[model samples]
Target: MGVPLLAIVAWSGTGKTTLLQQVIPLLKARGIRTGLIKHTHHQMDIDTPGKDSYLLRKAGADQVIVASHQRWALMCETPDKPLDLADLAARMDYSALDLVLVEGFKDEPVAKIALWRRGVKGEVADLLDEHVIALVSDENLTIDLPLLDINQPVKIADFIENWLR
Candidate 1:
C-alpha cells in the first residue's frame, strides 16, 4: 500500500514542531514508522563550510552525497526550480515508513490537522476544508470538527491512527 501522509499545519510560533516532537515518539511507541518533511521559506544549507562535500557543491556540482559509517546525506542545489509537496514527497525513501508527516506547505492538497490557539495571528474561522480532518487546540471550542486537546499527544496520535485506518 502507498504510505499514508498527513500535514500538521499552523502559523509561526504556534508550536507545530513542539507538538510533532511529542506525537512522533507516541507514534513510534505504537510501532508506526514515521517519515517527516519540513518546508522552510528561507534558504538553507545542510553542508558544512570548507568541507569536501561543501566545496564540491560550491564548485558547481548539482548534487553531492556525503557519507559516514553512522549516517549519509544527499545535498542538491535547486536554485531555479521550486518543489511543491508532491515533488518533495517523491524524493523520500518511503519503503521503510508507514506514514509521512509533513510540517508546513499548508496550501498543499493533503489531509492535515490544524493546531489552533486563540491568540495565534493566523487562526482560521473554521477548519471546514475537506483536507482538514481534525483540529487540536489549547482551549475547548464548539466546532463541529473532531477536536483533540492540544496537550494530549496520545489522544492525538490515536486520532491520527484511526483516521489512517
Candidate 2:
C-alpha cells in the first residue's frame, strides 16, 4: 500500500512552502521518513542550458537519469500532456518513506491541512471543506475542526505526528 499522503495547502503568498520548510525537518528529527511532491502551474526546468542532461533532453530523450555518488535525478519530458496527482505520486520510492507531503493540489479530494492568514486575501476561511482535517492560522475561529497556530511549527509537527498515529 502507498504511504499516507498529507497536503499542505494555501493560496499564493500564504506561506505553504515556508511552513513546510519548518515542519519537514522536525518530522525528520522525530525519525519520520518523509517524501514530498510539490505542484506548480508554471513550466520549470531543473537542468541548466549547457548541462549534459539538458543537452541530451533537448536531443529528444524522453527520459534521462543522471547518477552520482551523492544523488540521482530522473528528468522526463512531458510537454504534450500533464500528469495527474496519482501518476506523479507513483514515481516516488514509497519503501523509503513513512509519509508523503504534498505542497499544493488544493482542489483535489485529499486529506489536507489548510493555512490562512488573518488579513490576507479572503475575509473568511474559504478553503475549509469536508476534506480538510485541520486549519492553521494566526487568527482563531469558532469552527469545529482543530485550529493550529500558524507561527508554531513545533506544535504543527506534533499535530501531524498525532494524526499519523
Candidate 3:
C-alpha cells in the first residue's frame, strides 16, 4: 500500500512548524513511523561551503550522496526545474514510515489540516477547499469541516491517527 500523506499548511509564522514539532513526537510515542517533507521558496544548500560534497556539486555534479555510519543524505541540484509534490514524495524512502507529514505546498491536491490564527492573515479561503479535511485554529469556526484545538497537539494527533486508519 502507498504511504498515507497529509499536509500541515498555514501562512508563515502561523505556528505550522511548532505544531509539527509537538505532533511528531506524539505520533512517534504512539508507534507511528513518520516521514517529513518541508517546502521552502528561499534558496537553500545543505552542503557546507568548501566541503568535498559542496565542491563536487559546484563541479557540475547533479546529485551528491554523502554517507556515514550514523546517517546519510542525498542532495540533488535542481537549478532549472522545480519539482512538484509527487516528485518530491517519490524520492522519500517510505518503506519504514507509516505516514508522511508534508509542510507547505498549500495548493497541492492532498489531504491537509490547515492552521489558522485570528490575527494572522493567511489563505483562510483554503479552509473551504475539499483537500482540507480539518481546520485547526484558536477561534471557534463554524465551518462544516472538523474543527480542532490549536494548542492541543495530542488531540490533533488523535484526529490524524483516526484519519490515517
lDDT of 3 by residue, 1-165 (tens): 278889999988899999999999999999999999999888899989999999999999999999999989999888788668888888788888999999988888899999999889755775557899999999988988889999989999999999999
For model 2, the stretches where C-alpha displacement exceeds 4 angstroms are none
TM-score of 2: 0.94
Against the true structure, whose lDDT is highest? 3
Q: What is the C-alpha lDDT of each candidate?
A: 0.86, 0.88, 0.90
**Candidate maximizing TM-score:** 3
Clashes of each: 0, 0, 0
lDDT of 1: 0.86
What would the per-residue lDDT of candidate 2 be over residues 55-151, giving only the tens digit for each residue? 9999999999989999888888888876577777788999899988999988777889999987677644578778899999988688889999999
Tens digits of per-residue lDDT for model 1, 1-165: 268779998888889999999999999999889989998888899988998898999999998989999988888888888777787777778888889999987878899998888887875654346788898999888877899999899999999888878
Candidate ranking under lDDT, highest first, comes to 3, 2, 1
Clashing pairs in 1: none
Candidates in order, TM-scores: namely: 0.93, 0.94, 0.95
lDDT of 2 at 24: 97
